[model samples]
Target: MSNSQITAVTELDRSHYKTKVYSGGHFIYADEPTDVGGTDEGMPPAALLLASLGSCTAITIRMYADRKNYNLDSIKIDLAICKEEEMNKDTTITRKIEFTGDLTEDERQRLFVIADKCPIHKMLSNPIKIVTS
Candidate 1:
């Protein structure tokens, strides 16, 4: 984020949707399930999107818990993208968060407020423009 922008490179050969993605000093693979004509090597793109949001939500809450001196043992986040009939072409992400900690209801409520401020959540909630040539 400090660099203002991030870059990643992905290469796809003849292996259907299987692809290798390289980002800075890190690398990952993206693949579809065999039921969808892929080799089922890795998570599909949509899953990665959910993973990003869930991880960010957890990390943000953990940071707040540590700063507030709360006993936060673990955080579980479940994310799903669903399409409702009322909203056309709109993707709705259902995020279910579970917290394991010794804290008051106020503290837990604060975490719910803080979760929305995560970087990924902010990015996805706002307008996005992707350019390709």
Candidate 2:
């Protein structure tokens, strides 16, 4: 993999937890729900994490299928993260994939394997350390 670094910046004001995120010349909003004292303007932090994984998985599968000349129409991914009550326990993330295409059972199984090959999935499956300065 190329040694590339991605930098993202976020700004949060007194607007009840609504945050502005900027990366790669793009911008998006992250906010908490109204019940949590946010304006509910956009996806929360947890949802954003799942969105990243889902998009990466779908893109990886699509690229693989196209490269191998598989009859792939579309890909749908559903992801949910379950937080553990005990802090020491690991959190569970459930991902369900649906494909609309003409593929054999073997191909389907291979796609399942390919899903795990996504960069985000690999990153999440491994150990991560966040350093704050």
Candidate 3:
């Protein structure tokens, strides 16, 4: 087992329903929307989770294409995520990748295979342990 550890810190501001998160010198704010009594200061936790998955998928595909010297102009990834309680608290995330460039069908199809191979995708598909104090 790997002993490597990654950590982040978040503090809640007393004034509003917002959180300040610090990780590796980057600061992120997370909050609930105004409809839920928050000031809509930043992205909700759900959106943040979805963004991580989508961005990771795009970068993975881009890196693979670049390694092969594929002429890829643009890449677009769209993901929709939802939680279902009926399935014993199961969550589903659907991803759609759009590539804009001169590419063959095989290249495009190969990207689909590569998308699922992203680290984040693998993490989500597998079991994870979350320990909180």
Candidate 4:
């Protein structure tokens, strides 16, 4: 498998009433004064998820623009996730992607469609089999 496809494991340490999480070959601690016991120094998992989507969207747009030879100065994507009362009965994730740059109408629409084709977006939208022992 490719390096990006490799599985990773995290080990947590909780001795003397202190919590620490080790993952990606590094150690992370909960944020101080928050008491959530997450990476105090690093971003929480949920934040990381949102960030991943945003970053992927931006990078995907950039790649598409570069491939098309579009004179794109920059690409910014604002992502937000919210739960809808009726649709989120079982807890669903809803994301909003906003693109900002100098592009024609067609390019703008095409890029939006391309954003949905991102690797991470595909993985999240599709179902996967998880095995645990």
Candidate 5:
């Protein structure tokens, strides 16, 4: 098993809903929108989630293509989260992937399969346990 840690800190005096997030040696800010009593200084939580998944999917596809020597030029991923209370169902995430370069249909299909193999995708697709102290 592999473990990684990230820390998020929020100071009310600094902003109502802005948080400082530290992961590895990287730092970023997360905040809600201004209408939600935030200063809109950074991406909201849902946007961050989509960003992670999209990036992971792209990287996973790129790595596989490169390893196989496929003519993959670039990858673009679009992701969105949707929740419907009217249907009384769980939240759904939609991901659209676009690949550029000369590739056969078989290779493209296989790449689609590889996208789901990304760590973030697998983690989100399975049941997760969050233990807090």
Candidate 6:
């Protein structure tokens, strides 16, 4: 099986913890210093994951509309993630997609289906194997 991977390296310095996250050979800085009560200024890992999902959902819908030649004016996605109980064994994410412009009932329904089929949504819904060295 083929797999994709991202690497995140973090270093703790005098001011805050600095991190460099890499995906597809591209790197981005993610740091948060202790002064602001964040363990630095970068987003916590969970927040990053949420952002990915939100972005993927919105983009996927936009792509679908454009491909289908639908007159979609705007697409907005709102997402919230909640951990299950104290154990954190399970997490629930709720997504709300709002579409603007003229759309038929069929087009709207199809968009909802397409949104669920986004890459990030599939990743979150399917079982995942994580290896830590």
Best by lDDT: 2
* Tens-digit lDDT track of model 5 for 39-110: 899898889989999998998998899999999999999998863343223667899999999999999999
User: What lDDT score belongs to each candidate, Candidate 1 first?
Assistant: 0.88, 0.91, 0.85, 0.65, 0.86, 0.77
TM-score of each: 0.90, 0.93, 0.88, 0.69, 0.86, 0.76
The true-versus-predicted C-alpha distance at residue 60 of model 5, in Å, is 0.6
Residue 23 of model 4 has an lDDT of 61
Q: Using TM-score, give the best candidate's number.
A: 2
Candidate 2 vs candidate 4, lDDT winner: 2
Q: Which should have the higher lDDT, number 3 or number 4?
A: 3
RMSD (Cα, Å) of candidate 4?
Answer: 4.3
Candidate 4's residue-wise lDDT over 1-133, tens digit each? 1357434454455532234555667765433324644435655555566777878777887888899987677776665555224544354455665555577989878888988877778877777679989
Tens digit per residue, CA lDDT, model 6, 1-133: 1275545555555645556676656766666547645566577666677888989888998999999999999988887777424325476777888999899999999999998888888998989899979
Q: Choose 4 or 6, whichever is better by lDDT.
A: 6
The stretch of ten residues in a row with the least summed lDDT in candidate 3 is 82-91
From the highest lDDT down, the ranking of the candidates is: 2, 1, 5, 3, 6, 4
Candidate 1, which segments miss by more than 4 Å at Cα? 1-4, 83-88
The weakest ten consecutive residues by lDDT in model 2 span: 82-91
Candidate 3 TM-score over all chains jointly: 0.88
Sort order, TM-score high to low: 2, 1, 3, 5, 6, 4
- Which residue pairs in candidate 2 have backbone atoms (N, alpha carbon, C) closer than 3 angstroms, thus clashing? none
Candidate 2 local lDDT, 28-104, one digit each (tens): 99999998799999899989999999999999999899999989899999999864243243787899999998999
